[model samples]
Target: MNKFGVLSFLMALISVIVFLILRGPNVNLLLMAIILGSLSLLGIIFAVISKRWLSGIIGVLCNSVVLVSAYFTLLAYGIAG
Candidate 1:
């Protein structure tokens, strides 16, 4: 049970859920994207720093997915690429 990995996994899950639930073109889309990107970035860092391999890898993968998909969604709307 690596603490860093657990924390990273939690952050990744939260970001993914938020991205899915609040997804769409809206006034706060940019802000949400930025915040989610930062959250995923931190998750990636923590995953790299984690001692356990499984949790760390899962955290990194999930966070990566969230980060890329969120940006791509924004890119689709001509927001940020």
Candidate 2:
């Protein structure tokens, strides 16, 4: 994998860790989720453009996991209302 792909994978991993650690509803947590989601998406884009399939795959998986978890948690708590 290229440097960009590696970087992207790392960012996605970090985002996943952050999401797992902050498991409650709060404005700051929401903001962090948005930022991390953006970063993970950017990394996936870069990795795919760089032809780094492995890193891109990893990023996609990590981002998907975080998004799904966050969605379910927020929905279960009725935070959006």
Task: Report the number of the highest-TM-score candidate.
Answer: 1
Quote the RMSD, in angstroms, for model 1.
2.5
- Per-residue C-alpha lDDT of model 1 across residues 28-51, encoded as one tens digit per residue: 666777878888999999998996
Off by over 4 Å in 1: 24-27, 79-81
Assess candidate 2 and give its TM-score to the true structure. Answer: 0.62
- Candidate 2 local lDDT, 1-81, one digit each (tens): 788777777767777777667656564545655666576677667667766667777766766665666566556446664
- Clash counts for the predictions, in order: 0, 0
Predicted structure with the largest lDDT when compared to the true one = 1
lDDT of each: 0.82, 0.66
